[model samples]
Target: MNNLFLRNQLCVPVKGYNRAIIYDILRKDYFLIPKEHCAILDTNDFIQFDKIEDVEEREELIDFLVNEEIIFQLSTSEQKKHFKSLNRNFENPNPLTNVIIHSNIDFRFLDLIKDQYLLNLSIISQEIDDNLLAILQKVSELEIDSIYLYIENSNIEKLDEYKKLFANYSLIFSVNFFNSKKIIDKTQLSQNIYYNFFEEEFSTYKRTLSIDKLAINAEHFLEAYNFHSYYFAKVYIDENGNIKNGLNNLENFGCIKSLTSSQFKEIISSSNFKELGTIKKKETLVCCDCEYRYMCVDSRVPSKGKKHWFHQFECVYNPYLSKWSNEEGYLNLEESGVYISASGCTIDQEKLSENFDKIWNT
Candidate 1:
């Protein structure tokens, strides 16, 4: 699938630590793109294609998805047939112009040339099965523009294996934040080992680190990852918080914070961060009212009773927050007037297509 579709979305692991917390951040801050941004589609969303009946219905859905500019994954000939059924009327083309096939099917069946649709292989983490050699062999055959390597806390030691496997491909390492070290003590032996290991291995691969809760000083973390060129901030906060337009409130309150999306845009528009590429800033906004608003920058708050930061926003599993109840002390995001969320790591697919309309669209 095209990387553009999955640009702003966070692809999280269902089994990772603090999964609930991470997902909560996603629910509040991120909007879902349709089939065109196919890179972030999980197994559950892909299965929805099975329920789609008739070419017309499929085509309609595809039309809706195309506005989102996401690539849809059609793994089988049967799926492709369904897709083709919708495209019978070539006058109105299927919005989902890009199709991704991830099965172990022969490449000949794809019938795709370089000038046409893009093709990518879904490398299952388990499929690696401790066989580094097999993984490397498979990587050699892939014509993928990027490889997604799912890295877990337990598998940190095995990352070297992946580095060697996809040495030839442009690898985007997705690190799960379970047990992620929030504090790296250079003086400590364990920290030293990890720092050395990551500094060396991640030097070659474009690292995209996923964290459940952003650190207190998120900018520091961003710098630590070398601004990664790509990073997903999955920090959570309570829904019942005061909503503001910029970081002025926090700064006025004596907080040493970085620029907000609007500020960042102004800076970039004026040729600031020129060293950081021609960065374009886009934001999604949400509004809420709570006493902790100033301290909670963009709904990212430190976990209650724990000094360590944890997600406290719209979590599907956490029934105590917004999307569950509207009682005071609980989040009621639907009631919030305006909330701003930003993504600048990839191309502005939302602007390019209108399949998905979010709060920030206007």
Candidate 2:
């Protein structure tokens, strides 16, 4: 008997309450499949197609999988033995990889975490001043990979100065001047750097999820499987030098100035600080049943529950109904009978079952 196997890439089949998603890392895309189909893939071995329902529906599904290059046929057990699935486990050598600065304090405290070799540095400031230049000069000395500058209130008159400052630092690769009096064409800057001028205000706390934010790459999929893509190994320092996981995060570990090298490391390594990053989407309510769980990066702070976490804000997309909030014929998750509370999430199984065929059979 012939056997079916997923293609060379590590294709992960995740089952939701209503549907399932196949994350094709190689193609950088995903396919929505029925929960039953996901269960079939969950077997994760040389599949005997003949052993399935053997109906027209099953044949069509198998054909789709083959034609899309998601799966291939192997004639013999000997041939199957040579095929191996890739390991999806992720590991990072650095304890901290990214730093976000929202203040103009003496950032010299960065020396405490410099040993890990920071990959990215973000600075959020109100204006372009000598303080900004000083910070840029100091950071340019470090072996930092890249710097992202976000100025909330920008002065158009300083573009030439900004260009000169950026040219001085090779690591300052991206810059965004928000609330600019006049919009500047992006092409006005050097090709090596990404500089944009926006007349509208940009808030760090106001976040919204959309299909455009979904990253279908292998690195993101593997990391999202085990950790929070935004908060993991990332630190945010507010204007007063207070450190937190995110800008909106209320809990502050402590001010950077007051902390010693040992204390700083202890704080980051402690469960209290690391717990937020451990909250993977697969372990959260509503998000647990999302087809885009691993691919979508939703970093909004969540309310803690006994077993699972609840989103403090409503998600724009409903995985149960497979519809966006803005689209017509879209019913909110609550209308579908899934309730999120302090304890966790509770679902109306009967309602889910009744709607199953209506959704899939369409």
Candidate 3:
């Protein structure tokens, strides 16, 4: 057999307590293998099948990787001259990619951003009214890629209205109805819309991270590698037209109505406003060690300290233990020796090392 090479599209195995993950950026999927495989991936030298002592076991692993298209066989001579690697840099054409509206207001402010392409336009309001419909119609005329509408106290009659609206505005990707008093036939609802009756009302509250929210594609992987997953190119306008980077941010740039197009651009382009977007997860205290950092769209806005940024809220998933809060024998941040405070988090490195050895039986 020739020298085996891991595919460039497959990221190097990231080790966790229980397992290591090899993310296939092109396929938008992942493979979990024994964490010990991390050692195999650490070397830049080629893996020769003939040199292995555990022939049968190593062969089996190689066979599986080949079958899964995660690796390929190439001549050692060709590897030196012809091997290509993925470009890790990422850039987007649009200055603004996402917009969130907490409540409907004078949408004339949209004209400033009308020329810029938007990836997602989210409209969240407490009730559906003429004002909301007017804003929706105005937004429908724009070139937004997708629209997600969230309304509280929705009903069957509103469902029919939504059907008609969706028929007209093909860009309305999904409409989430929250705290509906009456449950309508879900079958009647279109594929894009959903009614969340039992769940809590919609709020811009920070949520815990989960595996489901992870985006496992090349675009997301590249973006997360270069910038903050949530705040990059994102703009949020609250009910009173106050503009901010995100829902939980304390800084208010300005009211949308007061700022001209040039003024708005100046505000967003300023270093202070753009500072948060530049803080990638790799710079965060606890998240830097996480295997899922590149794929995670963690909403909690981390606070920046002199040396590093830290998450104020607790995350549900523990990367050290490879366990979720819902899972059995899960360890929290404190239990794992991560102490979070207003300024930043402090890691009890000795205790963390001890826990790692205990959990993995190393």
Candidate 4:
């Protein structure tokens, strides 16, 4: 008890003054305690604190924090920090590559990522037309391993034609219907074309990184969490033939006619491009408190609501309350308080405003 010290963890404040969160990085657990109790974590030697004023039960909070490994006894005074290993590159020879190609009813001019064996492609099209076959043909030529076509399921008038055409490409294609569309056809489809079926709303998160995915890819994800992109390396050709960081992000990087895969990569790697993209859950508001932050597939371009950090307005989980709603939960993100735009952990006000301006003006 005497030798124990609070482990290095992340402390964040919820919007309301009532609650705050302490994320224990070592154990990958989070605790919601009173905002007043946050001072206990401020000092290196928490043992020096005798009383926490606002807390009704100080001992209880301490006991819970200790039990959660948020507080632990160090074996020595070394104060050493641990880092993740970077030795797995040699193991993955071919490497798994995923990309998204957004075409505005045209795929004839598409040319990017020509060399890599694409493991996945998510195509977002305004309408299904004759060019689709050309796109699929090009995909097959590119040796694209699998695909998920996002379109209005009900609007698919050529189901039979689609079945026949898609069958020829030999792609493991899934259809994601937006606008709350359901698979009404009731047709027993072949093994190749899978339906995007969600028994519940939480299942929607399965398409992104969720708990189940975290359990499987924890080690790999932990090492490469920064590379997580909501659009997943999208090379979008908007309806107007303009290219942006992603389909969700409107900031125009260049025109589809001029940009190449290599150029697209360079643009994304630039500071201006990264300023708008490359946000991880841990860097976000409430998402930082979740135990699954590292493993979760986060959104790069979520709806910009009232708060910069509260990107997921439809989120059901409330980390501060440690509760979830069947419907929309509280959406206030725990901002780092440094930036009015967002916390320092996320994009700053300067970068955010600049990107938005660039998107509108460009």
Candidate 5:
């Protein structure tokens, strides 16, 4: 879609760098559009075509943005010529950054740039209908990446149908699973699992799998399995090495640990092992002391925060301070059902580095 249409589609303020960094670590993939390229344009900054009676005034705003390097501007004649050329090749990736269109109305402007840019069409979940279908069809015809489907609990069934219909396309489904228990359970599969360790009610579960337990489990899982991709959503860690949530929060941690340990021992004992080359240690080191710290094949320290040395922020949900700040040190324990850390210890770089060395040698 054109810039104007995308500008109007934003429902909430974009979570820029923080979101980008977390996803990069979790997915082990780099962002196509770097975080530096993102910008939030306020309403006042918008160029309202309706307000500018004179053509020059309207053109001025467009020129300003192009000069500031915020967006690229093309002459009307040039845009028409480019649109014509777009149809010549459909397989080539469009280099234009994505634009999120907020409006519900039929956006004819989107058709003009569909082949030239990544158009993110956001429609209210409940309001989707035949009109929406037609718009999506036009997008599909252009062979764009895919349409992002945003849905709420009320429209989840419709989402399921949509998923089936566009199964062949590269569709990314975005939804808030916190409130939709039924939908969450329905989507569960062998490869996809969810655990609610952050909730206060699961405090006991949290205590059982302290950082040491979590690290051991992760090592076990990795050594035992040969899998392609692994996905974990909404995970967090705290001081005292306590684990909070994610797949590791599955029931029967004791059994899983026991089984994993036995298997690992068997494999090692049976093998004729040889020592790998060792490298020199550095004077200064950075580390992550999180519960899943060992299991995390991908991990990095946050630039800010006390635990900046050892802990990485893995959770997608905004950290709730009041809940995390509670003296009880458990998330979702009582009413809110959130997970909070008990020790609230920041990262100690030296300790983290030392632990890493110990784990590697063992």
Candidate 6:
């Protein structure tokens, strides 16, 4: 109980944030060095309990890490119990993963519902036939556990209808909208819908979902095995009915319409399918060390040659430099010495003044 031992965890320096992000790979837990903490005992070196400073601050951090299972007290029995549960899960990996199919064709949703899988119907249009009809049909015919419908701001009108329709199996509706818009009161709408305004062009600092909290809430992390973030382990049925491993991914397994269960096994059994599905953040460039890696929903296919293996222009932080970069277009002092316009554009002052003049005149 006196000695503390570091687990087989990797503490790597993040490229964009300059903070060391710890990956408890065996347990699949991730953590950023807490800002208030003064030190992270050089975990790269096996932490010797006696050698540590033993200050209240240091002890507090040590206690926190021990509890997190990143490192554990040698005599602690809880860590071993946690490890056993995680190892069992890792060994008997859940083959079924949720597929998010964005389709213009409504009937195609029927084909993907045969399994007791979580299906996210990212319906392109808001003003379509009620999702409840599809959900009700699926519930009656097939054995599905959960069904989600992603809609736009325009679909607010159909909310009441959705509530009555999906009342049975908890069919949720996720939307991209603003709170200020006040299309519907959340207290009432939450009965059948969930709002995800994460993609809204809204803020300075964005937030990623919490992996640990997700595990706590969902019982298991739905994203624990998700690697590429695109349709990696899951399936993506395109608008053209071509079944690909991911959206916008060219590697088509085959058309969904003609795919039998036998053909489905063969498609997913190929090396290419399995290879793309396992490309984790640890294998990615800047993201390899990012604390947000495991929690993030990164579309790896977009960032192949770019600076980061996720999205480059979308990223505001440089982990190696540890400085949050400026607006996407406006050049920084380190990059270019020239001053930028007030609008955050890298344009000359004369045009900026002209824009100001037009605004004032109007």
Candidate with top TM-score is: 3
Q: Rate the local accuracy (lDDT) of all candidates.
A: 0.27, 0.77, 0.74, 0.50, 0.30, 0.47
How far is 261's C-alpha from truth in model 6 (Å)? 4.5
Can you list the residue pairs that collide in candidate 6? 15-319, 15-320, 16-318, 16-319, 16-320, 17-319, 18-319
Error of 4 at 124 (Å): 1.6
Mark the regions of model 2 whose C-alpha exceeds 4 Å error after superposition. 51-56, 103-105, 127-133, 151-200, 349-362
Q: How accurate is candidate 1 locally (lDDT)?
A: 0.27
Looking at model 2, report the run of 10 residues with the lowest lDDT sum. Answer: 1-10
On residues 256-319, what C-alpha lDDT tens digit does candidate 2 reach at each position? 8888888888888888898888888877888888888889878689888888888867888888
Backbone N/Cα/C clashes per model: 21, 1, 0, 1, 22, 7
C-alpha RMSD for every candidate: 24.4, 4.0, 3.7, 11.0, 25.4, 9.7
| Residue 338, model 3: Cα distance from true site in angstroms | 2.7
User: For residues 93-193, what per-residue lDDT tens digits would candidate 1 score against the true structure?
Assistant: 21111122222323332222223222223232323344433553545453444433323233545645534544444432332213334435322222112
How does residue 308 of candidate 4 score in lDDT? 44
lDDT of 5 by residue, 247-310 (tens): 2333111111223434422322231210000000110012121112223232222222332221
How many backbone overlaps does candidate 3 show?
A: 0
Runs of candidate 4 with Cα error greater than 4 angstroms are 1-97, 105-109, 153-161, 179-189, 197-220, 229-234, 260-265, 269-271, 274-278, 300-316, 323-362
Q: What C-alpha lDDT does candidate 6 achieve relative to the native structure?
A: 0.47
Q: What is candidate 6's TM-score against the reference? A: 0.59
TM-score of 3: 0.84
lDDT of 4 by residue, 174-216 (tens): 7654443354543345656765533233224333433333322
Model 6: weakest 10-residue lDDT segment is 212-221
